[model samples]
Target: MDKALRGKFGKLLARYRVTKGKGFRLADHDPADTAGLDYSKAEARELLARGTALLAEEQSKLYAQDQWSVLLLLQAMDAAGKDGTIKHVMSGVNPQGCDVFSFKAPHAEELDHDFLWRHVRRLPARGHIGIHNRSWYEEVLVVRVHKEILARQKLPDAVRGKRLFDRRLEDIAAFERYLANQGTAIVKVFLHISRKEQKKRFLERIDHPEKNWKFSSRDVAERGYWEDYMQAYETAIRATAAPHAPWYVVPADNKWFTRLVVAGALLATMGSLDLAFPTLPAEEKAKLAEARAKLVAEKD
Candidate 1:
């Protein structure tokens, strides 16, 4: 919340932010990178606590201003810490001012419409922050990785081809730009987790009874297509990264570090919005003064 801490976070955001995707390589980013921060897990936790507190303050202003909204998109492979990041980074925010949506396989009705239909309808209203666990990017990620899924979409013959992914990416970029113009600040994050780290997490889930429910057999099946997913992510990022909808490739091997970066990214985005609590007009101030006088004269 202080100027010094905010500056530190600003620098961290610059390190991972991708506004232009030209020459971007997923391999260029280290999954274990901490941006030279040597803080222990406890130290990181304390920092995150502060960040969340500041975020809550900023969120209050955003809510009261009742104009700008924020959309945070988290995209990653299985076991990449998306859920944990959301839970920890947004802990201090008021639930009424925030909305979280997790997108899985599309339902029959969802598939009936275009890919972005379901997600578009779930967007947050003005004065709220919307978090998407996995979003329309899945059309280019999962659907791209698995061609069979695309066939199930029932697209017209004219729009079904090898170039469809590129076309979809262009549409996504335009959609995000439109949202940005309409007062929604967009921040997209990719939890960059290594294959080794993901495997370890999967094993932990299998071994821990408490985490068993979080484990899905399909998760392991998808692991076999790790490279495919990575390629899809790289392509999507390259196509859609823009000033209005920047992407943060946050490292996920270290959950603490990942959480800190996520918190910082959201903090930076909300901070840039110049959010402030609305000021009362002259008439409203007079009304409030009258109400205060009446309250003072009344019994406790």
Candidate 2:
């Protein structure tokens, strides 16, 4: 995508993120549809710059309203450009109000609690934005695919069958609904990059001097399970999608498009809350006018 179009795309996505939900669906992101967009590097640079500014403006409005929170859950396989998406799409947000949590292997304390326990503790406060690098969905994806992990959870032997999977899903849905009721709007993005794209990015990590630090042997190991992860992602998206918190399958083969879709999803989710500043009482408004007049007179 060219710089101008990239700006257009970014700006549009920002608008979509704040004002979305009218026609949003988790399955609407189709990789096939995104492959053909052609834009130059110069164009992308311009879009990225403007998109960044617009994001700040949108965030200001969201904060001033202080009525809701926007949660972005990004789930993808290794070598799937999660870092790049975070860098570009979220660069414009306020640092104080935006929280990005990356979940890795469970620690001793994490293992002691229920799977949802750690994640629930990190839920974004009102008027804030929370981005989960990998999330509670990991319980289903990593555990279901590798059942042995469940043995560590130490649930009772009676409820130890495949029904455990169903229980996890229910917990996720119920948790999300409770968040919604408490004034959070969530948008989940599944970055859909082809295996070919994955290989290319992996090579970039190896071949590029600056990116060499990013490559790991385990990345290749996880790459081997790409198909399994895809199926897991598909199932999770279908199961956890709810009216308050829906997922968007973003075509992430192109970094620019990926940023746009993710940004759009964020703006859309936040915009849905009918956000506005609290109305000033008439007496307070008059007092504020008098205060300002006094300040102006003192300055004179």
Candidate 3:
């Protein structure tokens, strides 16, 4: 992607990027803010197609160099289009070079270790992309909202309550900073969707037989804690967002626009890495030329 192309969408990302010490308040960001963007669904589709092509090319270089890795963690409320964002934004990347992990309630075994242990284990190796649908932040978001879940973690009394949330936030910040230092670029995306939009999606899921499987009563129950979840997300983003691991609060009301922003942002981030295919040494190039000549002669 050229700098000029990236700059256009970069503005969209900059508008939503939550910088550390900026006193981020989710209430201030509208889920439908498409300021300065006058693209139709068709236009967004075209933009996404271009962005994904660039992303695929960048990912190929990333794999060939085998130097750096990328981790994209997407967090959102239910029906906020997290799945759609990942599927559409990453559609062009080679599956072999990318992996997606969806985190749900922790299994009994996962609870035995630190909250981040499971997530850290899933980090992508060098020269690949890792996508976390829901991530370790659930410890701070869901668990914090529903306090009873925190008691199950069996933490020492000294680290319970606000202390626990604060400590976990610190751990996340340090963890991301360390990953950045170690050549793993991190992009955290929060798909901001309105409660009304969620309800609409949920009803659609119920009304359509093909989508019925996606509707769950649990999602409905959680809707009652909308305020709690919002506060938790706002606090978590504010505490953990840093230069190395910035958070992009993308508007989720328009799925097409969301996909475009996500794809464009990812491409811009990976492009900054200056990833390139590995160069062969002079001797290796000479040997390859000789081998190619021999193969051509044999074929003739």
Q: Estimate TM-scores for all models.
A: 0.98, 0.86, 0.97
lDDT of 3 by residue, 163-182 (tens): 87888888889888899999
| Better TM-score candidate (1, 2) | 1
Ranked by TM-score from best down, the candidates are: 1, 3, 2
Q: Candidate 2 lDDT, tens digit per residue, 1-300?
A: 134534545454432231223344434455534545565877766666666676666677778778788888888877777888989888988898889999997888998888888998988888888889999999989887778887788777987886787788878988888888888888877777788888888899899999999889888887777777777766666677666777666777778777766765665555556666678999999999999999988944
> 73-173 in candidate 1: lDDT tens per residue?
99998999999999999999999999999998999999999999999998999999999999999999999999899778989999887799999999999
The C-alpha local distance difference test score for the whole of candidate 2 amounts to 0.74
lDDT of each: 0.94, 0.74, 0.89
- Which candidate gets the maximum TM-score versus the true structure? 1
Query: Residue 151 CA error for candidate 2 (Å)?
Result: 2.9
In terms of lDDT, model 1 sits at: 0.94
Best-to-worst order by lDDT is 1, 3, 2
Off by over 4 Å in 2: 1-32
Q: Give the 10-residue window scoring lowest on summed lDDT in candidate 1.
A: 1-10
TM-score of 3: 0.97
